[model samples]
Target chain A: MDSLDIVFTGFLISALRSATPLLLTLLGECLGQRTGVINLGAEGQMLVGAMAGYGATAAFGNPWVGLLAGAGAGVALSAVHALLVVGAQANQFASGLAVWMLGFGLSAYFGAALVGQQVTAFDSIDVGAAAQWPVIGSVIAGMTPTVLLALLLVPVIGLWFYRTRTGLRWRAVGESPAAARAAGVSPATVQIQAVLVGGLLSGLGGAALSVDYTRTWAEGMSAGRGLVAVGLVIVARWNPWWTLPAALLFGGAEALSLRLQTADTPISAQLLHILPYLVSLVVLTLTCLRRSDSGTPAGLKAVMDR
Target chain B: MRDLMLSGPGRVVGTTLAVLMLTGAFFLAIGRDPVELMGLIVRSAAGDGYAITESLVRATPILLCALATALPARLGLITVGAEGQLYFGALLGTGFVLANLGATSAAPYMAMIVVAMLAGAAWALLPAVLRSHLGVNETISTLLVNYVAALLVTWVVYGPWKSAANLGWPATADFPEAFKPSTFFDSRVHSGLWIAIGLAVLLHWTFVRTRWGLTLDVLRSNPRAGIAAGLNWRRNVLLTMALGGMLAGLAGILETASIQGRLQANLSAGAGLSGFLVAWLARNHCLRIIPMSLLVGALLASGDGLQMFANVPSSIALVVQGLLFVAVLLVGGYANRLQVRRG
Candidate 1:
């Protein structure tokens, strides 16, 4: 391949890899918001997941176990959120922030020991026949289990949201808890379940970051990607399928930033680093302007309306 | 016991005790003597003059940031944009200092502070406008803007404003001595502490003893009636957000001028978020925020001492801080339930 082709392929591959964590997080936030629970603590959940995943991988010598641990850690954090926001009727935003701080602190504390330790991260799977295909071959060949799983989940979740009875119940609860309760649908149970599942997915995203993407542990390694995912959910207009492109857009910006950093260019790397967040803000504003509160969950409206 | 626990003072004591117990349990789980660590933390945070000064220094930004959060919160707005405002403030203040590098007078210092506050207010107004005009969620918009603001600072420090004297270090030129905020008692604790405390007092008085306080309550509790009463909702939102942003921006600039001596990346050290927590802990009470900010500041300041004296990571401060918030929530929620039951 030519140098230009090589750079282009590298960018594409990195973008896909970067999108994995964001897509997982976006999907999870979408689930939670759809249940009328807006979690501002995804960052915290992701951090704990990243730490737990790395720690478990180091201890068990298995990345899969690490991923599970990450998910568990996320679920544990989200449980606190659910208990406070749902059970105690606490402010969702406050509870979420507390969760984020907890996750951040807990991860930094626990992951301190695991730092500088090496783990055998998840290896990309071989696509035997697909490896020979042109253009898409290289990208397809670089797919890890987590990446494929995340991509597959987009469609699966989309289907579940549109087709399933449970999904319908969740949408109903999100729209109006009182109405749902009158319909004999327990909004509390569904909302709690949605929160836990959201945590699980967020944790999985963090795990993917540590085990599959970076293949290493670092303090606050998830950075603001969890927060970025929160914004992307709005960009996606709370739709499961839309998260795919939304996540990819962010991931592409991230990949392009990294690429530009290495290239001979006058544009500052720090300026490029601002691309993902700035783009998200602009897109989110535009989306909200075009369709004001059209797709917002009614239950969430009550919380934010204040 | 139940009645006492449901009371205001009882809830405060209960939450404090709960947080302490949880922290002890955490230390025990890590195979350390909780008592010794706890004692050490207290001493390190406020044992002596130096420690007290350090705690105060840390508290300054947090106090300002809390005021920032609390201001908008009065109007029932949950804004987590203090961090961004702080950065934007420091960026603008630093930009002013950098531009007037040849000005050998104290006049630029005042101008720099104003510029920074305006910059912060400007940054915060974006979300407020978006929320009021486009019906977007202020919380999410503010949160997103924060990252952008931080990156903006990073871009400047690493690019346009990078000091030639620093030799590749990603920081702007250090402030001239005239630009430095006056410190107290030959320590790092600057005049910013007094400014923060004064602002808190002023705000508390305004919130409790003024017509504006009643205005905010009416707007928050009954927006339709408030609108009918000739109160402008959008204008109030904009004013509160801007004022809050100004406080956070002041924090950013002061920290930059006093502690950092130059604008650099990660300057606020999570002061904005810490302030938000303190505000919540104080239940958005301006006066209450003072003591809460000090408490949190002491806890954070002790982290370094813990890392030094014990083999514990400094992040334990964060863990403890988080636990404190959760404990407060649990206690506060329980109290609310009890009040409801009584009613």
Candidate 2:
């Protein structure tokens, strides 16, 4: 293969790798929105989760244990979010912002020791001899376990939203809580569950970064991926099914930018680095142009109103 | 009916105790001495004139940044983008000073401040426009613009504006001492603290005593009624956000001129978030912002002192702030619930 082909192959692999965490976060936020609460705490949750996953993996010698620990940490943090947002009906934005700081502080304080520690990243799922298949194998190549799980969730969540009774209740609660309450479904309970689950997946997203992707702990290893994932969820139109492609688009943009950075180019490095965020803004602007909100949860929209 | 509720001081004390206890538990879990940490926080924050002065320096920017959100907050727009606004302000302020490097001090100083405020306000208005006109969420728009501002700063420092003398660190050339803000007695704490104080007082009066302020409160709580009553909701949105951004701009100028002395990475250093937290803790009462900013500033100083003295992660302070914020909200919520029950 020529250099171009080599670069193309590398881009595809990197894009898939980058997409894992974003996909997890987008799905998490989607669930939270569907339950009438939009948790802006994903950024902080991801940070604490990253540290928890990395620290646990280092101590326990099991990546799965680390992943679970990360999810548990996220859930614990989100419990605070649930109380402030759902129970008290505090300003969701302020409450979420506070939680974000809390989680970040927790990570920095707890993971001060974990910084720079490395762990063996979880290996991709093993395929039989068919891995030797030329073109197809390259496309379906090595991916962490979390990536596989995220892909599986696409179908599972889509089915759950459409087919299950619980899913219908979630939509109802999200659309009109008073109506759902009249039907004997507690919107509060559904919101709490969804927020916790959102935290759980966000934690997994953090794990996908520290345990399976970066394989090393750092102060802010999750960076702004958590926040970006939340925005992409908007572009995804609050559909869990759409999050997969939206996340891939982000990850792909990220991968392409990194590749461009290494090439001999005239663009400033900072300008190129900003390409991903600019893409998010431009895409979001375009989405808004098409529709104020493609399909917002009315329950979630009500919380935003003054 | 009003007297049936918990008094304001009672709620404050209750929230304070809860936060302290929760933070103590966290410190203990992390293998630190909670008692020592508590004492250390107080000592480092206000144990001496030097420390008190440092806290004031930090509070200057914190107060200004808080206004960036609190002003818009009264209008019921979530403009947490103050952090980015600060950067835009600093970037412009830095550019102004550098471009007019040879001009006599008076006009340049005035120019830099004005330019910084305008730049910050302009950055803030981006999200307001997006939100009011397009129905996009201002929170997300403001949030994303923040990253864009940071990136612009980074590009400038590393590219066209790099200081050749800084030994490869990505920073702009230092400002001449004449360009720096005038300082008060015995310390680095500059005149910016007065601006913070003066602005706080003015904003409080505007929000509480003026018709415009009442209309803004009305606009926030009931937009339809405000619009129906001939209050300009859209204009209110722009004005409040612009005022907020202008305050945050002053913070950026103070940061670049008084503290950093040159543009560099980490200039804002979470000032925007800290400001937002201070605003929330103050409950958006403009007059209360001063004390809240001071409290947070002291905590920041104490955190740094803890890092130096006990080898503790400074972020422990953030954990405390977060606890305090949540605890305060919870107490307020509980008090509201109690009143509802009684009714």
Candidate 3:
């Protein structure tokens, strides 16, 4: 392959890897918002999960256990968020900010102890062998199993959300709590479940980043992926179906940038590094400007004001 | 109805107890004694004149950032991008100081600070313009700008602005001691402290006793009410955000000139977030910001001390701060529930 081809191919492969974390977090935030809670602590939860995942993987010598531990940490952190926002009924923004602070601090503290240690990364599942065709095989060659799992989850979750009795209650609770209450559904219970599920997914996202992608944990490794996920939730209009493609688009931008940097492109590499965020910003602005067609949950903060 | 609420002493006791109990729980979890941690925190904060001075030095930028958000917050506005404004201020301030290297100390340094404030105010104008014109959400715009500012600062440090004198990484040259604020007493505490305090008092006086303050207070609680009272919401929003941006911008300038003396890739070190925390904890009350700023400063100062004495990572303090913040919000929320029930 020519240099440009090789670089483009690499970018495509890596974008899948990069998109995993974003996808996980965005999916999680989607659930949280669907139930009328804006859990801004996704960043903090991811950070904590990253640290826990790294720590557990390091101690147990198994990536699976680490992933579980990471998800547990995410859930614990999210529980704090759920308690404060759902149970205590705090301002969503205020509670979310506080959770972010706690997560950033705790991760750094725990990270101090685990700094410089290396853990085994998860092995990628080969889908190339199953593809039975060259072009498709090449495209799916190094894609992690987590990406496939997360992608599959979108449709299943979407179907479950719209078709199931519980799903109807979830929507009702988010749309109008008074109506939900009158309909004999408890908003608090529904919100708590959404938060718990969201936290689990967020934790899984952090775990994927630490174990499957980065292969090593360091302070602030999640960077602003959690926030990016929040932005994606806005752009996707809290639709799980849209998040998958949005994640791919964002991941693709990041991958493209890294590719350009590696290829010695004349463009300033710094500009490339910012491409994903810029794209998201533009996408968000345009999305906000356009007419809304996808049904946004009534309880979700993004649409509640409108 | 108001009389039944906590009295002044009761509120102080409540806030203190809330802070302490939460801090204690965190320390206890980490296998450290809360009393010892608290003592170490207090002593390290005031263990020596030098330590106390350092705390004040650290606090200079924090106080500024707190006021930045609090100013808008008092008017029921969320200036979530104070961090970005701070960067705009610091970047301009440093650029001005470096560009005017030949000028004598008196005019150039002061001029740089003034320009820094203007740059910050100008940076804030983008969000204000968007909000007033297109009806954009200030929170998201401000946040997006923060990312842009961070990237902009990164560009400056890493690109053409990279110090030609050094080759390995991006960093600006150190400011001359004459241009920089002087350390007060063998610590890095500098004139930024006085500047921050002076600004705080100025803001307090402006918001509490002045006509503008009354107008802002009215606008903050009820924008519709302010409009009904014949206050121009747009002008007041612009002015309040300007003041808020200026404070944060001053923080960035002070941080560069006094603390770091040179701009690095990540000069903020989460001061912007800390400022948000301080503003929230104070509930946007200008006068209350002083003690909260000091308290946060002391905790931050002692984070280093904890690392030094107990071999504990300073980030542990962050966990404590997070716990306190979450707890405080929960309490506030609980209070809201009580009010709802009573009503």
Instruction: Give the interface RMSD of each candidate.
Output: 1.2, 1.6, 1.9
Cα lDDT of model 3 by residue, A1-306, tens digit: 457665556676788788988898889898888788887788888998888988999999888888899899999999988999888887777787788888888889887878888897667676645645544455566677666767778888888888999888988887899999999999999999998888888988898888778887788888778877876787887778888888987899888888788889987776677788777767766776665636567666443332
Itemize residue pairs with steric clashes in candidate 2.
Answer: none
- The two-chain DockQ for each candidate, comma-separated, is 0.74, 0.65, 0.58
Please report, in order, the local distance difference test score of every candidate based on alpha carbons. 0.90, 0.84, 0.79
Candidate 1 colliding pairs, count: 0
Candidate 3 TM-score, C-alpha based: 0.94
Q: Where is model 3 more than 4 Å wrong at Cα?
A: A1-9, A291-294, A301-306, B1-8, B164-169, B228-230
Q: Residues A1-306, candidate 1, lDDT per residue (tens digit)?
A: 667766777888888889999899899999999889989889999999999998999899999999999999999999988988888778888888888998999999999999899988676587899977877787788788888889999999999998999899999999988999999999999999999999999999999999889989998888788888887887898889899999999889889888888986789888888888887888888898796667878887787676
| Fnat of every candidate, listed in order | 0.74, 0.59, 0.56
Model 2, residue B268: what's the lDDT? 86
For DockQ, the strongest prediction is 1
For model 2 chain B, give the 10-residue run with minimal summed lDDT: B1-10
Candidate with more favorable, higher lDDT: 2 or 3: 2
Error of 1 at B256 (Å): 1.0
Candidate 2: tens digits of C-alpha lDDT, residues B65-180: 99888998898887788888999999999999888777665878888999999999998888888787776788877878888898889889999889999999999999877778
Displacement of the residue A296 alpha carbon in candidate 3, Å: 4.0
What tens-digit string does per-residue lDDT give for candidate 3 at B190-275?
77778787888888898889998898888767778789979998887688888788888888988888788787778887778788
Candidates, ranked, lDDT? 1, 2, 3
Question: Candidate 1 — what's its lDDT?
Answer: 0.90
